[model samples]
Target: MSMTLTDDGQTFSAGRWPLSALSVASAVLIFAVMQGIVLSLTGGVFDYPLDDPYIHLALAEVIAQDQYGVNLGEAASPGSSALFPFLLVPFAGTEFHRYLPLIWSGVGLIFAAWLWGRLLVEAGYGRAEWRWLGLAAAVLGPIAVMMPMVAFVGMEHSLHAAATLALLLGLHRHFSDNGGVGLILAGAFFGAAFRIEGLAPGLIAACALFLTGSRRNGLATAAATLLPILMFMGFLVSQGLDPLPSSVQTKLSMTDPGDEPGFIQLRLAILLVNLREPGGMFVAVLALASFLMWRATPLKGTRWGVLVLVIGAAAAAHLLAGQIGWLNRYEHYILVMTAAGFLVLLPKATQGAVTPLAIGGVAALILGGALAYRLPMHFFELPPSARAIHTQQGQMARFVKDYLQTDVAVNDLGYVAWQNDNYVLDLWGLASAEAREIRTTAPVPGWTGDLTAKYDVPVALVYDHWFEDGIGADWVKVGEFQLTVPGGFLGGYVVSFYATSPDTVAMLTGALEAWIPTLLPHSRFVWAEGMEP
Candidate 1:
């Protein structure tokens, strides 16, 4: 049960548990230190790196409460992940959730690292310092070895990354071991539970697994991957939810989606953005070198023609429908895809150096370890860069409940939607259907005013640039929240409060004038006076 990839001078023994333990310990230590910095700077670990995790947390709380959606009694799929929310049902309201993401992240990194370590050991790289390569790769290796960020995002991405690694290694080991199909199946099932896009990696593994064996193997692989997906979708539909979660559908441009900058264009744009980073530049050079030397060291597996085809499948699956660079989580999986490809293929290129191609694969790990090592090369990133969501949405949620006393509309649904019981009309459409319609149709300025009025939504917390035709001055801006940070996503962001009803406008305007001193100490209230509603 050995081959070109995992074959070598010495067959790996079964008593390598200590090294495995070290790998897990190292990954846990790195995560703890990194997160400790963020916690010290941010005040609390509950302030996740991204606001989206909160959306899932909110839904999980509802699910825990035996209800649905971010607002109880609403049967909407606000969370894009399948198993993640349900998994949180047990810890939804407890302080355990505050620490759960870090736990999940640590465990995921450790699991993935353990699997990769086994692959390396089987390949004869487990001797001396080489055994530590897998552990380091989990924390910092390649620009895509972004385990730290994934873990901090407080989402299911950590598990997704681990699953991807398991599938890649299982497929690689399948023909030789003849017993990896179970690993493949388990990886697919568990991965798909985390994200809808999880299907892509699992499907790719199935096809690769089939190619490595008989038709029956292929059929079994397909069944393992597809059956769970079908059952899950069926379950969602049975519950009166969409087959695909609302987040997935909206992101893929199905139900009033975001501005999709084409497929090829989006991929190219992501590549371009990467080219700007130092780690990105290094990765590009290494990939080019690997490509030039691929034929001399093709992976042990068969490709239709090119050695890069297996990697290409992953790229096609992701790029054709993947989201690119939204708060960093969107295209982050591409990192694992890229790193896994190199791990498998680079060993082939350096065949002369103790299978030098394999050594070359190990060398590639150095780039990420150097760049993203400590604090990461994303130097501009602050420990608590998420202050906006925690403060703005949090304060605004309370403001709505205490002052407005009615349903409101919003674009950023995470903070405001979760912190209060108020019904939120999500302009981004990830949460509310009516909001999605408005976003899809893209009302003409004044049209949104009419729409809001129609829905009896008197107040909206939004950015002015969102409405193209403008909601007309009559809607009236009562307050403006300033968001400023160096190179931050919300830099210069101003959340404006507008009211439709004249009476409500007056009340909100007066409320803002009175509260601006206390709530918005440094902020100002912008009044659109003399404008009639």
Candidate 2:
């Protein structure tokens, strides 16, 4: 459970940490406990804003099948490498997929707690302030601690949070000491952050060099930090893998429009808005105190360098808004920095007086108490469960895997693709690079594929909504299932179904109702054929 790493980078000290062990273990435990509580509160498989528990299930399935970078031939896309997919594959294969999201959530929370605690201690929080330090860290990292459970259901938010904190901590140490392996480790964290999101941390690193007094140290730090990324890219290239045209970039180019305010205003606005959010008010108060602190201290030596990096990074990210549409997730590390930014200013703000710290601590506790009161009591909104939707999709998948025994092509693939072993047309990612290509010179059409390939897909799981609106008509309806019974959302969970048999013009008028006792009664479904046929 515990280990140590020594100066020579070789032996363990008589008895100590192997560097960040306490942080890692604490993170894991915190993540697990939080996950258990949340899952117990909400039944298993809650998928509201994101109705794709199956996406993760699919990723784990791919890894389970022992296929690396297996695209499942759905859409013009490849699998993502955000890490959680690979991490959860075994669990999914073993029917433990329901708990995968919670596992990552736990990991994120624990790491966040550990990082905040250790970083605060290292930043010079006195023993008397440890309780305040813990409270402030939680308040500052509210998003880091909880959002990973809600918004980051499938992605690697926890790892990203941990890495971002590590990067900042390493950067802080680099500014303090300025030589040796710590600098290299700082660079390594930078590299890890780069792999997470290219623009934010990269911009921060670049700006740090420009703003810091040690041009050589800043530049050295930037170079060393980027080394891991460069090496990783090089390895990919060597393996004949084109890391560019990457899933992250391709997805960004497609779904998101690249237009937003400059980084400085945007970053500032984010803090304000986060503060305004029911869950973010405590963070907002801490942010105000932090800003006050930064104003008092400004920047001295390495601290000044770190400030320069923060400002520069924020500025550059804003200026390049035309190219890299600002997705808030990309800037999650800002949570940790804002906390550090406040500390850097603390000494000057207090001016050797204990009063400012005391007032600030009390204010943080009050704000945090208010936020904690509101989130669960008033905003106790939970998403619908995937388990409810899974039955019919699972039944259909079982039919295909057993009786039908043929490949399937779905237009709007979600959990359906993951439950079955059939091939998918697209999996909610790069496969539909239509959105991305349309914003470019050539203006390409998305999903430009030959559907009538050698492999015959006997079952087509199409959703009528894609065609009914006439927004997209690439598919032909072969069959349908309709429900005549008056149906309404039952406790925020809607259950409805439609079935289309192969070559059937649609099922009987009330086939949906007829199969109600048989099928899982999905929120929506359809049976259809591809346009190429």
Candidate 3:
């Protein structure tokens, strides 16, 4: 039940194995249980809760074939994470590709849990009752930060969380113990590679080092952080694409373009909007509590203060420039880093006291759990969420691949593109720079028609309301796939099928008629008005 420092004085031994190894085992066990629940609900089909993973898989498939985009031979930067698709390249076109993201997620969970355990040990939690607390913290920390949900998302976020934790852990070690500079550099590099937003934490930590008089380490951290991102941008530029991914550009364009506010104003506006949400409020509280803990600590002038500063600055930056809730991802890295920073700092701040820090830690956990009140709900909803994606996007992919057997246009491009080799014209602009350019530059009524015609796409499956002004007057609404269950994480409950031209209507209608009988449970295909097979 107690942990003791190993001979190297770097990690703690909790029996025969290191505490980190035990933590990894605990995390894997919890993940397996969650997966079992989801599998049971979904009839043993291993599917991500969101359709987004498939987009990465689609890009990976093409990347494996010496291409870089979802559409074969077309060099496009659609994924937000430049490194994730390449990570999946080895598994691409293999039977194991679909499970690769989940596998990586499990690995990330294991790594994060291991890092959390090591961090607790490094923070002086290696004796008596504190040791038990450290063990509990290692097991519960990931859950508190919603790592299970991040894993279920099956995206780059889990690794992003782990890398961010590594960065913080490195910062702690370098400043407190005058070591771990290598960790700092590796964390900075891989963190940015996983998610571009990761640079925020790395830059903040680097600035902290510079201010703390570790000028050489500061510069190294900065260089390591920027190198991968710059390389990715250069690669995109070389591919004749924008320096940023299309997904990033599209998200930026969607955020109040009409106002055209100044940078400061825009960031402040975004921060305000974030603070209005429950999660945002929780982050604000966490930051405030972390600052107070730093102030209360005798070592405020030391590395502990640096950790608090970095965590606070990173959380603020995320609120200002990053997204918060897209299936409880996006902000997950910040949550994990912040929570881990708090745990590591608590023992030091409390000066090894039992009652006060325990009370404070419990309070913080309760507060976070309260705000994440939806965590349990989301856990149970995972199966239904997967079902939603499967019944909606999965069926869309099915209809396109099995029924139409030709190129198609779609607003949501993940499942359809991943399931088929046919050309998929992304109207929402995540995958196609041309589609993004068209949507952002020329927001007109008939632009979809022109774009589909340019790609020679015969049909489209789209959420009709999403394109209020661009569905095209000439495009026929041939049919729709309506999910009977709750939409959960879907963009819409009903996905409308459209024929790009009048000549394609009969073909689309017949395809829909044939596909109707094959519809999954809790989903129905309905013909559009005045249209029947």
Candidate 4:
């Protein structure tokens, strides 16, 4: 409760929980519950959403037992991105060690959310606007509901979010308190975030630096903190260990699907509609805040210059790094700061005036959180709808747990592998380059053939609905299962597969034909293998 950790010449204290900090405690509890539900459903599984989660858990487990690297069930090589787990290893002896990330994420989010409100109010959020700003900071944003909802133990995501918040806060403090300590501390956390996701955090920090007009100091601080890490990475490279993957280089080049500028733009635009529509009210508030900042205060010289730099850098970084279509929500942080600058420029005339802005902002955030929670439930499902995705996921997980035989091999199929203890030949292992090759390099005529021939994948869970473009047909659907309703799980079909073998064919085909009607009520199941005739 009263522990201290120093980084970059600054000390960070995990202070004792203050009796007055009940609000923060409550927030943490709420966040924990949300995360716990997902964890429970997934059975503490670490797969899919990229293999980073498994790597983190495996690393923590390895470090907990004081080993260099060991197989964590389904994981291979313990993978790269070890910093987050390394931090937790020291605390691993205690129960809190295992749940360290959960604690940090829950607490970090709450702290960030709380500080955002105070920062806004101090910068210029009127009493009326405080509630809305708080709501916005809590829900809408790049690292909002979705990331936290899925990533309870996901340190990288949470760390990135928390550090981004800290970086923003540090910039805010630099302008308001002329606080060098905050700047240095910001550099450390920001540096760690970059260690996890290099490009985005680095971009965010650069923005923060420009915003503070302390580019020289910010750069120096960042370089100093990151230098050690870089040197370590170089050492690894010398020893023939690529600290990270070429995927990073590809991501930096914006070639990765998610990082592509066009895709980011499209996504950002859609998300920004939250602010853009509804009468341009949020934008109006931002414009007004900027105007006020310019009008009243004698905030000139280093203070104003730093502010300009901070605002500019923050704004540019938002556009450059974040999804372009999500501007409405992604811009939440910048808006908060923009509001602060307005307040500093022209201290609110009356606390009473912000009532409408507060109402508007809060409403926007609630709507955002609601939407954020439900979108993935719907879109990423098999059928692309919420109606049956949850149950469908349950059914798939249950089926795998019950029937999967032989060590399984999959292409980017961590979610399934994580749920059960089958030896998974994960095509998407630590070596993402291999994964890229697997995906882009064509597969054999049937998924089973490809696995057996190329990957020596003995058994597979090939999806049945590739005609619908579900997960692709590089693998064939050897087995089939159906939800009670079509698209109930997601939309299309939730079929199972087994390798092309005499025993597998008979077992899976018979099991499915018998099990399908009983479980789903109005579903059909068939074995595509017999069609060979």
Candidate 5:
């Protein structure tokens, strides 16, 4: 189980594994299966913990019908992933779309482990045989801990994580071996399709290539990453939508722009908060990693020098563009990638200076603490999380599509938007550029009322407090859908039902009148107090 290295950090003879990649693969598979089982028992293969992934499916459904957005005809940029909607095109409206995202998580687990094997070997972490299996788990365990969580969340984050590792491997190979253009391009392409923020790791690698005088490779890297994003953005603009996604705009707007905190100060404060959060261990390890990367490579032409620069550049990017504490989902991929990237450098940094056991011990302790401190899931969180979306939003989508078949205003715009073939006037604006603009940029008088009036929304399913003053008076709460939903899954779990028009009142009332009786056994829907038609 011990790996003996020479002064230059290379082994004189290969061990039993000789880079078999078996141990890493097995570890990843084990975790994937554990997460898969949890997913199956909790809801099924077509289930997800969060509703955001459904937003992509909603867009995919729109694309499937030769249109855009949830309303079918209205074109809008809702999901943050650049090519995710297109990726879901084949199974957009099919039952398989929901299941495929989790599958991608498994693939990411395997592929990332494969890359990790190469990276460990390249960094002289030693051979990986049956004996070293435990060592592999100890060293690479952080990735294993997060992979299943990424999969269950059912976003493109799994792919994002894999793409990031690939880019790191490509950069090291490019510098040391004068190899890896193909790997670089593949990672960049993953960024283009996986998630818009996924571009950071690969784009940073491309810049490293250019900085290291590999201009041809650099150009290819840039083209691969930029082309798909440009195409997607242009398409959105052509359809008269914001180039930036609604998620991006909304998250940025969520950050307070108060005169006291000051914009820069608030972002700085948030940035510091993010580095420490999700887990305190990452910050400590990443700080150690910065020093390790610098020592590992020469400043003039080495990969670590490039890596240090790129990581610093990337941290700045995340500070400006990213947020944390949204159930540890938003910044998960990049954070893990940063930790993994530093691990790659550690072996080289400590080559003759320290023992391999020393490095392994450090990594295991830090990452293990992170896992122990913040368990991504507990059995208690699963049922309520699933029930919230499946029972409430899923039911709401069905009601809007089958029972009412009318445009409605809703704050939570994923499941209903995707499942129902109706236009949802997203009050929070994850699906509507105009709504986001009204909420953020425009100082319009009675903006919410203006939005409702402009859209002519017949029904409104939002939080009770969302519709204030004029807007609240205009709508009547005929019914409400309440469930013992968890707060961790959503910032605040509130899904209400309102009748925006008189006809909507009658339609909802009639449907509830008939359906409420059928739920004599048990159900979550009932008439709003004293406001039933």
Candidate 6:
């Protein structure tokens, strides 16, 4: 089957099955290769590079039992996406739950690839070599978007990217064929549910619709996109917590109520950081060039111009408010959106004067350079990255679960909280509102200690340097977990273990002594001072 584009280049026949299959197969192959690398490094243990996914799983378990936070019956908004954990509720507490995110991500990849293929077809790339190039881009989407990386991260990012594509495709359909308003709303609601950042593209597309005089559709789109987020925030508020999820509030460093900078200044500061990133700069330049080319060409009329406005506005919004890179996960949807917009606009901008070969060559260079910049390096780094987490966080989980068997304090919360039934005090603020408030508003000497003492936390596994103001005078450095693994993604190579009081020092040291022999290869526990058991 082949896609057929109409004369107006606004619509295409339904024939994306082959492209969808190709994309799924290609993604599976890529994922299999990544898993092979991970298996080789960790002796066949499948684990995510970052421990954040486990946090979601932990929350899912709690939610399944009619709770919210990681600890049982504790109400806290730790998961960023208010919807992701609930989605995992059915699978929570099962061995299969761990793979659920990967499966959902796979489904998202297939749909995204299919939608992108349809968009490319509408853009007049449905035939011959152009079709093949479109298929390639459809399968991989965009190199800079790092779809594979996000899919493997076991998070909602892949689904978020897919929803963004759906919105973009819906916008194209609306402008060109005066249809697909349903698709836009579906994209908006699900997109926002997947990630709050997803609202930027949806809202931008809705505004474009409004400006293009589709007022009813625009209003529906705006409401549909924002409803889920508003509902989530309402849910958080009902729990006597902050309106936003703890994870979101913690990450938006600028919006802290205690922050000195005004909101606009902080936004500008975030924009500055975005521009400083090489990937961010490249995307910005591409968006600017695309906007210029669209204005210069005959395609700047109402229909096509809407696409330009939506894409440009979405990119600008992301650069101003969203994050750029955290293992190439955040801002992926914007990268994909920008790349798709550029591809659709390129031929129109050049009026077909540029040969397909030239265009493909330029795309090849850009994709190659982007892949070189992060993909290959991060791909190989995945295994070691997982290993590092296993060596450090995973080991910590084991010691806490098998030995401590009680509530403890830790700056990094994922693995430990997920593995144990004990209460986990997250000093990092992601799972603890109290901790977040103290860190942001009242960070001072012994602040960490005060929080831990309040929670009755006896031991803490944290990075000491992270607390320059001191963890607290009551907190005694008992030992440290040192990862000997080289070239992996981690906050630090060493995680310090501190007993909240001197009396607990002996207990911690004894636990460390008993657990040291079982430590993962290449990681060891170093005793502090004369505390060696």
* Most accurate candidate by lDDT: 3
Model 6, span 308-377: residue lDDT tens: 8788988998888888877767877887788778777765665544565427634753574365346677
Ranking by TM-score: 3, 6, 5, 1, 2, 4
RMSD versus native structure for model 2: 7.9
Cand. 6 Cα-lDDT = 0.77
CA error at residue 419 for candidate 4, angstroms: 7.9
* Candidate 1, 150-247: lDDT as tens digits: 56567787777777667666665564453576676777777677666767777766666567555576666667667766876887787687787667
Per-residue lDDT for 409-509 in model 2, tens only?
55434455565665654412333344334323333232212331323343455444432342122334434433222322112222122222334213322
> What's the C-alpha lDDT at position 304 in model 3?
68
Give the alpha-carbon lDDT of every model: 0.59, 0.43, 0.80, 0.43, 0.64, 0.77
Quality of model 2 by C-alpha lDDT: 0.43
Residue 167, model 5: Cα distance from true site in angstroms: 0.4
Query: Clashes in model 3: which pairs?
Result: none
How does residue 142 of candidate 1 score in lDDT?
Answer: 27
Model 4 spans with C-alpha error above 4 angstroms:
1-26, 29-82, 85-104, 117-155, 177-183, 186-191, 194-216, 224-243, 246-302, 321-405, 419-422, 427-432, 441-448, 464-476, 482-495, 500-533
Task: Report how far residue 516 has shifted in candidate 2, in Å.
Answer: 3.8
Report the Cα RMSD per candidate.
Answer: 4.9, 7.9, 2.5, 8.5, 4.1, 2.6
The parts of candidate 1 lying over 4 Å away from their true place are 1-10, 13-26, 43-45, 65-67, 93-103, 129-139, 142-144, 239-242, 254-294, 298-309, 344-352, 355-360, 368-375, 401-405, 470-474, 506-533
lDDT of 5 at 272: 73
In candidate 1, position 296 carries an lDDT of 53
Q: Looking at candidate 2, what is the lDDT of residue 277?
A: 45
